[model samples]
Target chain A: MSRNLLLISTSTTHGTGYLEHAEEEIKSLLEGKKSILFIPYARPGGISHSDYTAKAREAFERWGISVSGVHEYDDPVKAVNEAEAVFIGGGNTFVLLRNLYANKLVEPLRHRVLKGMPYMGTSAGTNVAGRTIGTTNDMPIVHVKTFDALQLVPFNINPHFQDPDPNSTHMGETRDTRIAEFHHHNRQPVIGLREGSMLRVKGDGVKLLGPHTARVFLQGQKPMEFKTTEEIHFLMDAY
Target chain B: MSRNLLLISTSTTHGTGYLEHAEEEIKSLLEGKKSILFIPYARPGGISHSDYTAKAREAFERWGISVSGVHEYDDPVKAVNEAEAVFIGGGNTFVLLRNLYANKLVEPLRHRVLKGMPYMGTSAGTNVAGRTIGTTNDMPIVHVKTFDALQLVPFNINPHFQDPDPNSTHMGETRDTRIAEFHHHNRQPVIGLREGSMLRVKGDGVKLLGPHTARVFLQGQKPMEFKTTEEIHFLMDAY
Candidate 1:
């Protein structure tokens, strides 16, 4: 049986700290599902496996969902095999890519997702769903041993879309400009998800969530903005 | 009919309260050049254009080399054309990129280089030589309203190479892992250049500068280290 996949971006929980509002989002997704298998992948920024597990447990308990950390399960394959849904939390994108490469988990995770397991990823986790985890701003918090990601989605996701800071002194590139550069090099529609917003991928399309707006940036064209109620079918072509 | 270009990447300057060490390197580059044109194209940090111009002027004055600020020239083309050599000083990568985009000077500068004018970049200035300005940790102090960069070099340059900070509590990817991730998606080698070090690109090949070591990271491979004397032909391939 194929399960649904939920991907939550790391920026979504960046405000309330980890596992606070994330619990509410997770519970809503896994309301009736039993044996929810939580995979806190993309643990960049030097976050230990235990810390991610604890965050998931806090959210799972609030929703009355049974949650188990896959990292503690000696056999990750077994843990993933029995789970009805998968949740990927965000942190450092490179660290996540490193762990995924070290464990050779990309293929296995892809296989499970293909079999219809519901998968969820937030922030850095959401980064993995794209063609490559190249757009993440998570500093290389760890030495990246490998760079492999679950290429489920076609384009990159830029989360935490807030207005530019006025007092920041470090000037390298803004998020909008970075995505524009990405478009200049690669012809892909980068999904810019503002805070309190999401792209819910259903059977063959993605539906915007929350009241925030989403911006689709493509090369050689003006950026197109969308509202929460908009249905984005172009995501089907992303893969 | 071509001017010289000088790129300067310092080990440390006085602003960060760090000791200055690249003064000699700057002097050596400007030693024989009498009619020198100083271009402060990469002052992303709070280092004002006048401040950078003044710093270079002081350095050159010590070496008896006449340094003049070309930024005051209303027409950038006229200013660049009249110079015998162009020198780009370092600061913040984001700020540099933003200014470059705002002025739309990337192509004109590249044209100058192709015309056999001497070109040089230091720190963030050196990074502008790459295809994309992605390997910078400089904060986005100013919103440039665009992410355009001077794609002189194909690979991303990670300045200020050091081991992971043990005391940093900030989460997410480390600098190394982030560059590694960039290597995964990008075939071009990501070069980690330590302070006082530089990759001097001549006509056909590139030579390393300074005494520090550089690490070239690629996807699916261990980081390959190099020395100052090594001739990096692969860099041409990146372009």
Candidate 2:
């Protein structure tokens, strides 16, 4: 079986409702699937696992897709293994990875996705789909056993990547600088997916979705920006 | 024996010279010491360890205080133990922590610092003075053996803490929200030390130092702001 993945930069852009911008792409990717097993381990600030799950459920229910939180199952590993489709929502990457390790579902989840069970991730969710969680923007609130991630994709994904505003005077490092620093210590290519953008993968092919340009960072090279319409499948083999 | 530590939020403010803003405080902290040890493991971007060390050396040489890069020594553990004062410069927290572990100097450095050796850290260096590196804003370009830091202080420190720019359209979580999310999983109090700010520690007493107000986040309570002159020794016992 071939793989299918919808790795979104963020669930929502500023001033938009949750997952609203990616609704059409999500519908197409999850077409004909009755439901999705939601991993709510990344729980955003002040939200419970059930509440986060309910949020995911509400988003999918609008399109007539049922949702079940993996946390609600008796065995999370079994739930991930039997899931028709898996959807990991946005939040803290460290907590999400820690929970996945605790549940011993990292390999099971990866195996299912690689075997063609539909997989989708947003923000922290999307971060785990890459080579490692080294590019995450989330705070490291907890300790994970390792930085190794699912590696469903060949390159790491830096979601919600925003370009530096020329007018700002903040002395802190920009997103580009951070990714460039990552390249100093890592050889894996990193795709900086801006808001409203996503990577749609089917089999061995991938396409950049949405309207914004994606920034690509290669080790020992300058970062380059690519329009949404560009063919970037070469990223998978460019390492 | 008591500890003497100076944890600075940033080495420089906008448009300022390197370590220029805190030069006076740094001199006072290292009073009577002829030389200091510099750990440049937090090398930023493409800068080499020697270059980063040279930058620190130049900053301290202006005050007649010499600097020796710990990386240049054959035995980092022995060097850290024999150092008059230890200074860790700012950059990527993960890389700094990784090098500390790789050199097998985490425990040795911590022991010396706790035994009355003066210790100074800026940004990433300050982040490691806390119990763990959970509140760092840097990208995880590499994996450390553990998030456990030197624990020279009782609580976690969020260096270079900036308030949200209301005019911006970016939807990423602010420093406050990130720390709040941290409290959801941890009970440790986090001090959001802004630029141009620092903490001066002497034995069991610590005083906030600088011109800006530091933000403090307790687990469930609202974040409170404290003036630089306020006595914050209670933080050591709060958790």
Candidate 3:
């Protein structure tokens, strides 16, 4: 099984231009690909798909690559079948997955990626790359038929994971507490990717990129932290 | 229509005993009722339902009132129908709603509450009282059949609502941003209740209790802040 995936925590970081922190990695992932298909269904800040696609176009054109939104074509499944690469920008995970199922693109997209077409996603996009969207931080603006996601990876992804702040006064559940709660009902391992962190999976191996360490959560065990330069097999292998 | 609902933002506030902060308001709501049927299905922090019910039992017993978990009865619907009052404590909204649907308690609970049974909830309990559980801050640890909730109130509730921090370095979406995104897909108004805040509904009148102002968001209009003493007609009346 040859699979290429770039799962990112966020599209933008604090005080940085969009995708600026992961620019080099993104370009390298798209090397030798003439054009890429963009899925903007997440619609950050409730933006329209076309407007969101324009933002992606502006970013990728800088790297001498042309971008086309999947919504621009009449047959989205056909677009995925012919695309050289696919990129999904982040927003609301529920909204993205609902639209993905609505267009019947989940299976077609998964099949294409299994054959080794490069695929990359950020935030909500990255969340859908996991087994289920059950761990998303986004509000359920709308409900999908099911929580079943792409299953590109066996474990779930908790994008935008932040460590608990000892000095904070907010009483809302912390990210760690939320993921721990997920394990009570679900058995999948969860990779908590902090800002500026990403997971690159090629074939059976996975690499953690960026400067921060990724937090990994499994059922019945304490969470472990993985640095940018470590090999974690449980992350890439199906549990 | 006569509806007695005490929608609480949280059971506990910063640096306080559980339900200690809202004890007076809760006591006022439950006066004359000898007992309360507690739905501990939310199970905060993955605690057992009996343990959560024990917490509620401890709180109400202090006020000369008694509490029993719905799970204690083999027929939850009968327990709800025969109960003098109902209380749902704080926890994950997704888990809470899924269990509510699984046990077939949604419609029965709604009917009993509409018949003038005193009903109260905190956090996730507060969230399910709205038109839908679409505005909760909790993560989706489990998937529910629908975002459709009890619709006890016309508007949705964003409990534990916090304003955007001006000096924070975090890149995650703020509470305000998340609610704005909710309005893009859903047409219902959303009420943002900060900690130590609650809603009191009786007959055709609605009152905001506690100390903080509630933020009201309607489609195609700027979010308006309403004080505890303000008259909010659109709140009690279904949109």
Candidate 4:
């Protein structure tokens, strides 16, 4: 059994419907699977888990795939174990990880995904599929027992990675600067997945997908840009 | 003794020298105090503690005030207890809090500030002066023992808060939405301090200082905007 995943940077892009840009990839990833266990723990915009699950259901309904919110089940760990495919929506990473820990679903979900169950995540969801949630852009609205994640991927994923606009006057730290700061303390490689960018992993192979180029940050090195057509599979061996 | 503090949203604005915008406020806050203790734990841009303290020293040299980096002292806890004035510089909030806890300075630093020591903080420094660092915008490069902060003020502070840009195409969550999501799990009020803004705390009174208006977020109420001249002391009693 090996990893089968589609980790997206964002569910929706500017002026696009939810999951519209990744509809093709989503359909391809869930080709034979009829139902997906939707983990709505992220709860974007403070929406309830049920409401968030409904939004995911609507999105997957186009392909005639049934979706169930994990929280709806009496035993979330059992739900993850029995799930054919799992999808985690984007929201607050700290809150999402906290709930994952509280429900004791982290190990079950990780085992299922690592055992060849198809897994899809966007934004905060993708952040948790990495080695840790240390690279997340979301505010720490809540505290988890640890910054640890599922470790489905070797490196951390920084979703919605924005390029510094030379014309802007805002003085906030740029995405690159923040990632660099993370490197100062930790030695993990970080992938800055821009909007519309994602990574596809199947067994030992990994590839960058979508139109944009992704930025890679290594400890004590300048961040470099890599395109979707490049041989990015070597990133899997970096760790 | 009562709280005597200056909490600033940012150390420098665009096209301005470090601490230039708040020079007057800094001078007034440190009136008759010749020297101050500087906590350079934030370490923005991966700069060293000595370098960060040197920057603060140069900034205060204009006012003939001597500055000492707390890290240079043999006993950081004792330094915080005996310091006449304490300043925490802006950088990474998680790193700052981690160092504070590692060096056993949280209790002493908070005790001194709560006992009427003149304290000043900028950016990450200001975030810790609140109930918790849950509202910080900085990246979580390191994990602290706790998200608990000074609790000198009643509500959490979201420093360098930005309003949603109508013309921007970026799809990231706005500051207001993030703070609103925080309200879903926590009951504490959050003060969204925009750049160039500072809160002046004297005894039991807190006044909004600076030219721009500040945004306040309550658990069940809509966010409200208040100007510098407004009577915002009611925030001190919310907790």
What's the lDDT for candidate 1? 0.64
In the range A144-225, model 4's lDDT, one tens digit per residue, is: 8899998998889999999998987777898888998999999989999999998989997878899899999999999888
lDDT of each: 0.64, 0.91, 0.91, 0.92
**Candidate 2 CAPRI assessment class:** medium
Q: What share of the true interface contacts does candidate 1 keep?
A: 0.03
- List where candidate 4 sits over 4 angstroms from the true fold: none
Candidate 3: clashing pairs of residues: none
Model 4 Cα displacement at A148 (Å)?
A: 0.5
Put down candidate 3 lDDT per residue, B60-135, tens digits, no spaces: 9989899999999999989988999999999999999999999999999899888888999999999999999999
User: Interface RMSD values for the candidates, listed in order?
Assistant: 10.2, 1.1, 0.8, 0.8
Model 2, B1-239: lDDT tens digits are 39899999998888799999898888899999999999999997758999999999998998999999998999899899899999999999999999999999899988999999999999999999999999999998898868999999889999999999989777778888899999988898899998999999999898899989999999999999999878898888855
Q: Give Cα distance to truth, residue A123, candidate 4, Å.
A: 0.7
Candidate 2 Cα misplacement greater than 4 A, ranges: none
Name the weakest run of 10 consecutive residues (lDDT summed) in model 2 chain B. Answer: B230-239
Q: Which ten residues in a row are the worst by lDDT in model 4 chain A?
A: A229-238
lDDT of 1 by residue, B132-231 (tens): 6656654333334434356565566777665565754333455677766555445667788776666666665767777777888776688888887798
Off by over 4 Å in 3: none
